[model samples]
Target: MYNRKDKQLAQKILTFSCELEEGQNVMLQLVGLNGIGLLRALVEEARAMNANPFIRIEDTEIRRILSETGDKNFWKNQAEADQLPLMKKMDAFVGIRASLNIYEQADVSREANKAYADYFVDPVHFKERVNNTSWVVLRYPSEAFAMNARMPTQRFRDFYYKACLLDYEELAGAMKPLQDRLEQTEHIRLKGEGTDIDFSVEDQTWIPCFGKRNIPDGELFSSPIRSSVNGYISYAPSVYQGKPFDFVKLDVRDGVVVDFDSSNNEALEEILDTDAGARQFGEFSFGLNPVIEEPMHDILFDEKIYGSNHLTLGNDYEIAPNGNESNIHWDLVCIGADVYLDGEKVREGRTFITDDLKGLNPENLMQ
Candidate 1:
């Protein structure tokens, strides 16, 4: 039997998250786990609103088998399939991730995984899905994810729902001042233990994503000028594809990561060397979700930790384009960073200093 909560969450994804419209066609993709009640709710919600909903589920077991055996060229040919055409036809895309095993691909070597991703998954998802559709990606609470978070299974489920189903309208209204400030700022600076960085976002558009592109989303993001990033930043541990990157440090010189390190030093270097744009700073953003307090080994959640800021490497989204394009867009988070904008100590330690942003003052919103 499916829980009523599943149906509730699915309704939010269709109605609020993706804004299912009349006559629109949506593609729902479930990974590694199933939520049949949520599936029913999504289909019914779509049809009730005159939208078409269809699902294409992919299990991790099958993907693991493909990655474990498929050669580089085999993956390349798979990429050549016409999935792009079909994906482009999608007006809305919703991806549900509830993996039973976080380390489901532990047997697949890193090199094999990278090659397969470069050819197949990355091309279709990044090049096609991200830029084209009204999309939202979210993780369903699962035992494995709860274990990674060091929380009890049921407690984590409660946390997940509370974080995802925020009153975004109130949050967006509160962020208007900050968003306006970002639009007019030329240079921004950040400082903290093992971190001090400078960058400019003079003309770049600033986007405040409150439960839109990402469920549990509370961020105001803008890409710095590709050649304007300077100084260094030490990020808290973050995970990518089930691998933990801890104490990740990067030295930026003229917008490029000239020096970098992480728990897996060699792997970090290889990731940055994916392409030229991979070495350049592609994204800079703040985390504003007050309830999400710490890292959970999940970017979708960690990147919204209230007191953190994430600096990403690789392609910047068109919403705040910096012209740095690559197959990678890794969001590395820095905790307890003292953020300074245009010489003013505006926001430090996730707590705000500027009165202009008093609208977002946690005291006002959290209750």
Candidate 2:
């Protein structure tokens, strides 16, 4: 049986996030069995909206098998012949992922992962689904998710619902001033322990994201100028493609990553070497979710931690493009970074000190 929160979240996804209209089709993608309750709720919610809902279930284990066995041509065929057509036809998409074990795909070879990402994920989902359709993607609370968050199972569930069900309209209003400020700024600087970076967002558009593209979201993002990023940044620990990374540091010169180091060096090298764009910065953003405060080994959650900011490597979003494109879009987070705009210190660690932006601080936002 589905819980009330599941139904509530389902309603939000359909009505608020995707805005599923009558007679339109929305694809619901479930990545593991643990999200079955939420999936059922979404289906019911879609039907109530008079929208035709399509289901596509995927398992991480099955995906690992395919990656290990399939060749380049195999992934290409799957993307072209199967996934792209369906994604192109959909009016909206809602993806809910869960995992029994976070390391299910940890052992897949770099070559195989590259093929899967290049042929299948990039073309079908990133290009077609993201740029074309109204969509929202989030992870369902599961045992593995709770463990990653360092919380008990039931407590994590409660926290997830609370975080995801915030008053997004109010949050968006609070973010408006910051967005305006970003639009007017030319150079932005970041400083923290083991991190010092600065870049130009001159004419780039700043997008205020509040519970639209991503659930539990409170961020404002804009891509740096394609050739304007310089200086190094040390990111907090994170997980990518089911593998853990810590103390990840990158040295940048003119937007390209000149050198890098990480706890998992081999995997980090694979990501940076994916393509030409992979070495350059793509998206730069501030995290403003008041409820979340720490890394959870999940990008979806960690990228929204209130005291943090994240920079993406490779593949800028269509909404905020810096002309950097690649098979990977990695969001590396840096916590407690002081932010400066045009030489003015606007944020000191987790607190926004600017008068106009003070409402975004955790204390004020939670009020």
TM-score per candidate, chains pooled: 0.94, 0.98
For model 2, residues 1-367, the per-residue Cα lDDT tens digits are 7999999999998999888899999999998889999999999989987899999999878877887887789999998899899999999999988778877888878788888988888889888999999999999998878988999999999999989998899899999999999999999999999889999999998999988889989889999997989999999888887788976999999999999999999899988898999998789999999999889888888899997999889989889988998878889999998999999999999899989999998788888
Which window of 10 residues has the lowest lDDT sum in candidate 2?
97-106
Mark the regions of model 1 whose C-alpha exceeds 4 Å error after superposition: 34-37, 80-82, 106-111
Score candidate 1 by lDDT: 0.82
Question: lDDT per prediction?
Answer: 0.82, 0.90
